[model samples]
Target: MYILIRYAALSGKRTATLFPDTPVAVACSLLFKFVLNVFYGTIVVENEHYIPKNGEPVIVCSNHVNSLTDALLLVTSVSSKKRNFLRLTAKDSQFGRKTFSSWLIENAGTLPIQRRKEHGDQADNSTTMDKLLTALSEGDAICLFPEGMSRFHPTMAPLKTGVARIVSDVLTRNRDNPEFAVTLLTCSLTYVHRWSFRSDVLVSFNPPLKLTVKDTPSLISTPDKPVDFEAIKSLTTFMHAQLSSNTIDSPSWDLVRVAKTAARIYVPLGTRMRLGDWVRVVARFVEGLAKPVEGTGAGTGGEGVAIERQGMKRTAYQDQLNALGLKDDRIRQSITLSRIKILWRLFLRICQTCLFLAIAAPGLFLWVPVFATTTYKSEQLKRSGPVWDTHDEVAQTKLVYGLASGIFVWLTAIILTTPIFGLGLFFTIWFVPAWMWLTLRWTEDLIAAFRAAVALYRLLWVSKADLKRLRETREDLHGRVMNVATEVLGLPKDPEAEFLVVEGEEGDDQPSRWAKHQRGRTRGGWDSALRYFSIRRRRKRDWNETLRWFDATEFPKE
Candidate 1:
């Protein structure tokens, strides 16, 4: 009887008893993992230990940003050994389409919830609730997107009450089992460039929130009784707060980019900034700037002041780059050297690129079709999807389509190579993917080196006096912004302390040593200059450190 129900689910028909196919789930997970690795350059998982080792009953709640990638990242990151049974709750429309997607979702153990009305009447959600409760009761790890839908917004959308309601039902049903423990774990996905291929992603898992029948007495509803509306609302609010704290929120990507650039300049030379810390600082700064000021005759004074200060700093930074005939990319490339040194660096880079091209040439021929198809599909999806208002949405659309198209490309490559290579089919099948991965990483480094070389060439046109003046103005602007940020964030008003720079332990002679040390680090021309400013022997509290205080206060944990 159970097998029949499982077969029905796989056939795209609603079934009362849905059983997960472990082998299908594992295969789907591997496919998603392959696509993610090909799409993203780096996938950094923070506090992964927070994911409960002893499965018990768990529901993973995460903010929905990237369309399907959010669910893919969460599901694929967890080891199958750790949690053998994993299921997801998706909208009913996704399952009722009678398309390939429906088949995929059904086989992956996804439970569909009706999100719309039937002919102007409310559709019954009792079945969906019952299915969710049954899954939890069986100790399956359920992944849910409480936001209900994906958006390109910098901050998370208001969470729906479904997650809270589901939890409430599970707790009520398990009232008799005192030993049963259900854990709610919050995960955050931060994309450095959400829609772009070969971009970086930060996945953070916050400590789980343990709940029992005793923990939410007010939220519990009997099997036949309706859930308490107020209790569900309260729980939703709590979940939103917890989810928001772990994730980075910004009003716009422009502001985030500005803040990140400013932070690099604002921090003392010889110190490195963690990406998470940079995100927190930007969030805090933006939040602080948005807050209303006290004792202002006009309501816009605080906002106006922040805007003016931020504009002035941004302008100053841009002007300095312009004077040197450079842009943000070149500045970040950290190419500060004499003409003779730059020429030497350019020669070395050319040699390195030649070496890489020679090695990558064979794989390029095999993977070009895959790359071209994915890129074309991604562009078409971006232009056609509902993303005209924001570039972020366009990126998300491209990523969704790109990943879907990639699976076809991979399969095609395998099919084409298998018949041609015959006995060597296994090696041929894996070659293109491995080649594509290397190409993605190599191309990025190569471009950076090329940009640094161009910046170096352009530096020859600038006079020393002009460069010095620009540097002075840049520092002055940075100081002003720091002062304003400090005042707005309620930090100690020590202007001198903000500009304090700690020299390296070996003093002025350290540059040569650092240069020597960095020579062995990477082949990129920017390494020496970036390392010179970013390498520190010890961590110390500075203006950048003060930003954390605001982050903690502004986005307090629930």
Candidate 2:
């Protein structure tokens, strides 16, 4: 399945390269996407017209919310014929052509990235930065998921330093060239029925912006204050600004709709399902196969009745298999959130372990002490109040006292002249065990930070699983509704859309979904329920909901 996607991307690249400008490439992407949707279903491109028609060395930075398909989605959103090819930044794991990821090599000329320790795993066997910098210098337009990897979240996640780094490098290198002002544009993808028909997924584009180094606070700093911390702040703001202007008001499911539309209406895969004004509604025929075959009066009371839901348009040709199928294979259930999160978890675990072990190795252990303590202290010295600020004359006195004691240790160790005294003499020879102290502190901080990260990831994992189950219930409910849509009151032929409005309206009127979420989380088989009720009777809402999130799907899916 993944191979087919890579195949389409590669073919699209070859097809798009024939044309000039980025638009053709986008067009080719669209065509290729259109092609893939034949079997994949439709991917509706919403607000895509917002993508800029022209720009200098532009970047289409979108929230990397899904799979590699985001790359092609960008291409097609603009045009299929433009040739200003786009190169994507991919992790180093996809480094070589070793069968499984071989197609990745063929399709996306994905620039392999191996991180340089910036606080993850001090693991840098390969310099992905050099490669990324090299690519920037190559003058090709590219896109990066500043978050580093596709993440699961209701809204756009936090910006990472990478985007800032890329912008800084380009601006710094091309300081004098007007053309060097790299245009960074944000593309906010709002998925509708992400994998089904009539998706209202939107790909809104914001005006391109520039990241200039001249905007920094004094590329240099004053005594005691040693870093250009504000510069990072400015760059971070730019990332938010890049997409802020383009984001539209919508919920999670909206994006699914858009993605599904684009997915289906897209071009064919291989050469088997090309488009020309019409598609084999054979794909469209299954539009609601889940419905009864004939007013509940056919085989098995009409349950055996088959339907094929592809785009309603009939194509020039139909595959015999599709024709013979008991159902319309065009539209399909979207890849569930559970599945996507599972994959994300797998990817994250692998990557995190690689990061952890690499950073934890002996080579790093040698410096861990330095990074942990001394460096952190140095930084603290820069940020904290002056040592004398406590006006605690006591601190200065301690400093003096400790200094005198150090000198006394040297004198005493010298006088003792024993091997143990020699060791004391050696330590006292230097200042405050300073050499080993920094790295030790740094290691502790690193461990704490990783602990926080692991904690955060655990929390996220629980949330991911819980959310998936909740969504499954909702989707299952949706499935049930569809199976009985025509039969239900207040429902449409496609009631999911209607359910959306109901959900939205309820969202507005509810007394804080968070509150409801907490109550919902209590596990129960009557006893647990009784316990929850007892606890609820004594606790007020404020303190209760703050720490408890047992609602929305119970205990989270850890």
Best-matching candidate per TM-score = 1
Best by lDDT: 1
TM-score of each: 0.74, 0.37
Model 2: worst 10 consecutive residues (lDDT sum): 549-558
Kindly give the number of clashing pairs for every candidate: 1, 85
lDDT of 1 at 317: 68
lDDT by residue (tens digit), candidate 2, 268-361: 1211211111111111212232223455455443432222222211221122212222111112222333545645754665565456455445
Model 1 residue runs over 4 Å out of place are 1-18, 96-103, 117-122, 178-180, 222-228, 268-273, 295-336, 388-422, 462-469, 484-558
| Per-residue lDDT of model 1, residues 1-558, tens digit only | 000011112323222235635677546666666667666644556565566643377888888887667777776666544555456766666665665445656666665666654223566668767877887787766788888777666667889898887888788888887666688888877776676555556676766888887766776776576667998898788888877765567666555545555554544331232334334455555565445456445674665566555564366565457455564433433336666876788778677667656765766665566557656766665566455233344443444455555556667777777767755468756776666656654554455445545666676666777656666666666666576566665433442343232333222211122111100011123423464222211132221211011101111111
Predictions in order: lDDT:
0.57, 0.38
> Over 4 Å off in model 2, which ranges?
1-32, 39-55, 80-83, 97-102, 105-107, 115-122, 125-128, 134-138, 195-200, 211-227, 241-558
> Each model's RMSD to truth, in Å?
10.1, 26.0
The TM-score between candidate 2 and the true structure equals 0.37
